[model samples]
Target: MFPGSETRAGRLLVRARRQGVLLSRAFGGPEPGEALFARAPKPWMRLLPHFLALAASASLLPTTVVVLLGDYGLPGVLAGLLGVGQAAPLLLAGARPLSAWYVVFSTDVLTALALLLWGGPLDGAAWPWPAPTIVGYLLLCLPLSLHLARRTLVAVWLSTAAAAVLVGLLRPGHSPGSSVLLVVLSGVVLLLGGALRERSEAQRRLAEQETISEAERSHRRLLEERARIARELHDVVAHHMSVISVQADSAPYRVQGVPEAARAEFTSIADTARQSLAEMRRLLGVLRSEGTEAEGGGAGPELAPQPGLGELGTLVESAVRAGVAARLTVTGEPAGLPRAVTLNAYRIVQEALANVVRHAPGAEAAVTVALSADGSALRVEVVNGPPATPARPLEWHGTGHGLIGMRERTRLLGGTLDTGPTAEGGFRVAAVLPRNEPAPGENA
Candidate 1:
């Protein structure tokens, strides 16, 4: 023999040993991962298993006793004991099918052996599997088919067929048709039960996939809203930078009798401002290109000016016209603040009132604007009471991103926002923004 052939044969032997161990484990009692019969969803369907078990027990117990006593002439005590053993297992088959099957099968084999050994003259009686035993076995197989793994099911069916064949060999004179009938009917029940289990599993997986898809779409919308805010801020800063560059370049010409040294200083300021502007435009170009791609290639940034605190009165008026008793109040002297702060503040109020119109129909709303005592921060609050009447159903539902947009705006300005329900069953939204831009690295 070649040297390599010995090594190959040894590897094959190890593989075969592993497979044999797995097969043996499959034929044993139920493992930890095996599926079991689940409770039915509907309230009425849940009682079906109990009803079937009761009906089967009532009918099979008496029939088995009659057959054994009249046909086989067995003693009353032995016949009653065997009848109870075969019929009792059906009650527990839904929860522990494999253990129940073991009990039922053992009783069947013992009864057949008892009839073969001590019985009346068997002149045309069914020897091995009588009608009651076959019915009980088939009933147990219903739950087994729904719960057992494929490997375990195959092992069980094969073992049952093998046992039937051996018993038929022992009694050649009795009818052989009972064994054939039991095997064929049990096979059909298993096939139908397996198909139903597969269909239920497929529906469960489809529902899970739909939930995951909805979450992904919501996350994508949040990212797009943030990008839109960034683009608008970029335009505001660019406009201010352009004015500074033009003023510096023409400074010397505006003032008469200027020194050369000071003129050279103005030129240097203009050069630095122009360089910064160029870099900012390049970055803005990349943002716009990406936005265009996302929007199918035809979208552009809005050219109209962004709104500020001056526009709050118009927003409140529109809400008032739409059935809400809305009021706007100013508590402190208005101070000149950064454009970004004012823009975000206006948007926060706008969204708050819109929510009132949509959710709290016919409710009273109050909008308050105040400046801090030290004049370093601005506070804006909007509160609305509970609805006075039932809200009418509208065909269009919102995208559910209003709160997310408000939170994002506050974070960008390094400010804090608080929102919650009020004591009188109303909602309140409050925000505090710095009057000036935050110091470098302060937010970090």
Candidate 2:
């Protein structure tokens, strides 16, 4: 036992000093590190002792058989066969569960039967043949627990006692007193060894469970750290990006002699940047939280005066300002659309316009925000014509996370997206979102 591992129950079994010495040796001394093959079963170690017993029996059983049965070569051959029989169950078990216990039980029964037939210790005919029982008991002691092991120990003792009595009856001249004493002592040793092995097995299981629990806790902590970092980055960095965009839009308009077209182009550029920054921040915030906004609060900061279908023209104007020639068109009355639906519709257009600026710069684009004929849903679509030049800008880089982010947001709002290239050399992002009835205290 290590310094802190000693238990009150274990200490009570034997003398403190003697038990301490034995435990220290078994655990590999005070400074012992983990074993080289700690987790693997030592099958060879158990098999070695059984092999020795088989060799001893080869000589001992045959010599005794010659005396008891009076056959020269025949007695030796029979004795050798019986000796080999003892090892059969041990080899058959081969890493199977509870194999140690099965081997011990088989050995005990065989020993009792052999001793009964041999008459007594006085006959010396096959006295050494039962020696393998001790080896079997030691092998079993490795993996069985003390609580259940006691029952097996008792079984071995009863079998040994019965064999001793039968041998005394069979051999009339043998001293029954000494023979019985030896048999009782052997039973006691088997019990002690098994009890020690059982205690070790229980301790090993407890240690394994603790290790598993510690690993799980470590993994959970890592996920929490990532979420915290995401939330902080969204709150701080995304806010500054929005500020830069708003300032950029005002710059061109304030300058003198700037053409109306040039001023509109700069304003559009500012709108696209602000929109992209907002969407990214919301996405980062969503990733940081445990659940999505549809399950509770909105993605991030709530717009002071939220945009609805009425703002579709302004969105188109901003895209035009950014260098894309955008035209807005409406098909039906868009009144009474739910706030959630309106917000998602705005975001869909926003992301589409941002993709145009980033992926198809200086392209011609069109915006359409329409209410369904049944007035149950709102449909928003942004279509951008192909880029002007054959190759895109050198500064533009796409991480590929944007499309997935957009689709996730739409799904959360109970919407579906149909996005792909158009027949007229353009890309389109079309989404249809539901308008749920407002709950109490919610704006309609």
Candidate 3:
């Protein structure tokens, strides 16, 4: 032999031994806490195994006992013992299939030996594996194949075949055909059961994957909505910051006899506003990059200037053109409000009216804008009567993005939004947006 041949053989032997150990573990009996049946999704399905067990036990137990006594002419005690042994496994199989199989297989081997030893009438009846035993074992294999690993199932089949062969050899001429029949039938049943089990597992995995994918999609959509809101608000806020910077820088020149301290304060305000604008631009750039990536490497459509309270009239007019009976009412004097407040208020009204148009076709919608008594806040309410036409089918639902956008807008501006069905079988959306922007670290 070569110098390294012994070492190579030793390595091969070690590898083979490790594989053998893994196979043994794979084919081992059921682990503690292993379930014989998977949890059924429906409540009614959970009772199916119990029903099957009860039916099989009631029928098979007596039939197996009668067959053993009549055909094999075994003593009544031995026949009854074997009968109960076979039938008991059916009841046990639902909770512990491998254990039940062990019981049934052992009884089968013992029965074969009993037939061999006790000289019974040599009628042309199926020996060793009687009909009832065959049926019960086949039923047991259903759960076994469903629950056990493929390697364990293979091991079980091999063991059954080995036992059958051994029994046939012991009783040389006494019905070898019965053994072959049992083995073939069991193999076919186990194969079908295994196929069904595999398909069920695959479907379960697919459902779980789909659920996970949906959650991820929802999360991504939420992030995209937030980014879109930020981008819109950026335009409003950046404009204000630019105006502040301009006014602060021009304050001393525009006003007469400005004090030195006042000029320094104006200079400080201008510098702060410019710095804020620079920061906002950077944030906007990041948002745009994310938006481009989200849109598959292309920029979104060009956005129009952000809308405000003034556009509410046009919005209502558009809704009116879209088959909605819509009217706009402004209460109290319209005052100059914070740009963020006005923009969010417009969006809320727009979304609310759009919802009415889509969900309540041919419905009359009233858009009411009320300025608070002290001009501290503005209340925007959109209420629609019941649809004159039949509503859309439940399946034709929106993606909820409109509501999310409205809520986000209101929340950022430290507002209160209430939405629900009214007594008149219509939906009402009411938002109260504060005139001032939310302070930093304020909760909406």
Candidate 4:
């Protein structure tokens, strides 16, 4: 076993220890390289590795020339020319790394042949050394295409062994067997480096995949929690509100024949509470379910007999009973409106009137439901005179989540509502909706 590495199971193992000092003196440190070309941009960075490889390849030239010129009696200048020929193609090889494999192989073989031709194997001038050039080859080539492919690794080992044996035989007294062993050792080092690089890349990919999977799981949990909260609020709050409206509506009848005057006031109170509760329940349902049920077939109570254009008068009468001085005015012939449109129209009118009783108490209101010339759309407005007295203190109670609820409902039905002070000292609410339903399976 060599000192810097260990031999195990016939394969050499170089410990993954930092060789910082060794690398620094040979190629200069990375910091110095970066500082030297700091002002240069992308093209320079791309070419830097090739430049370093060229420097490394050329470093071997001086030793080669010295051996040839001093012992083989070749002219020093001629040796320099041979050195340049061997190193120049190596520089090009580094520039286009993947395409340079055969070029590098040829360069090494030629340099070995030049040594043998200048001086026979027995000559001291044939040094049999291309270690520096080979080191440069590994650095530039590894990142480009080194892999753990068994066949490629074996091929590289056999080729290096053959080349080393040839070079040793050309130089007499050098054992071809030892040269084969050394070449095999170098091949083992390349294989080790390639294995570690592959493992490092695989670990990086696995970590990224885990991170993405965790994020997706967290998102799914948050969505599930939101859905659970919606279901809870709708089932508890809306259900109770519905019960309250039903109980309030039945109160007057339950307390009948017990003082007419007192009974009348109680009936009015019960009716007002029922209407308020009904509107509140509708709002809770809308908020909790996000109007999804509207698309699924108008959820909650079944539509035994839904209000349509023909029942506009009945709606106006109900508003009058609810203590709002209201009137209905129809302009065009109201005939054959679709179910969804008719339902939406009734809801708009209902919500508008409800606002008058709750906000503009004891005020006069007007309800107008109309059609366009071509009978394409319906317009419904419920405008009310401002409160006869100061604004009701009871109006601002609760969460003040009603007006917003009404606006949401109107928008969901693809309708618009405008509410504000009128020029003639009144408050106005106007809504224009369609007269035809969306297609048979369509939603609001």
Candidate maximizing TM-score: 3
Clashes in model 3: which pairs? none
lDDT of each: 0.70, 0.52, 0.72, 0.51
Candidate 2 worst ten-residue window by lDDT: 1-10
Query: Relative to the unseen true structure, what is the C-alpha lDDT of residue 55 in candidate 1, on a scale of 0 to 100?
Result: 87
State which candidate, 2 or 3, has the greater TM-score.
3
Worst 10 residues of 1 by lDDT: 1-10
Q: Sum up the clashes in candidate 1.
A: 0
> TM-score of every model?
0.64, 0.37, 0.78, 0.40
Off by over 4 Å in 3: 1-38, 41-62, 171-177, 255-262, 289-303, 357-376, 391-395, 422-425, 437-444
Task: Give one clash count per candidate, in the order shown.
Answer: 0, 6, 0, 3
RMSD of 3: 14.3
RMSD of each: 15.0, 20.5, 14.3, 21.9
Pick the lDDT winner.
3
What local lDDT score does residue 281 receive in model 1, on the 0 to 100 scale?
71
Candidate 2 ranges with C-alpha deviation above 4 Å: 1-202, 217-221, 257-264, 280-444
Q: Per-residue lDDT of 1-444 in model 4, one digit per residue for the tens?
A: 001111121121111112222222223212211322222235665467567766766775675566556655556676676555545555544334334545555556765666567544443232454444455445534533233344655666666677776777766775454455446555766577556545544554454555555456545544443443344334433444455555555665776666767667666766766676667656655544344443556554332345556676787788789776777777665455544555556666766666566655656434343433127666766666555654453353322223343455456456676666677566565666655533333222
Candidate 4 at 126: error in angstroms? 5.2
For residues 28-128, could you state the per-residue lDDT of candidate 2 as single tens digits?
A: 21111222123333556435444644454454444434443342223445445544444444432223314544544554455445555543443443342
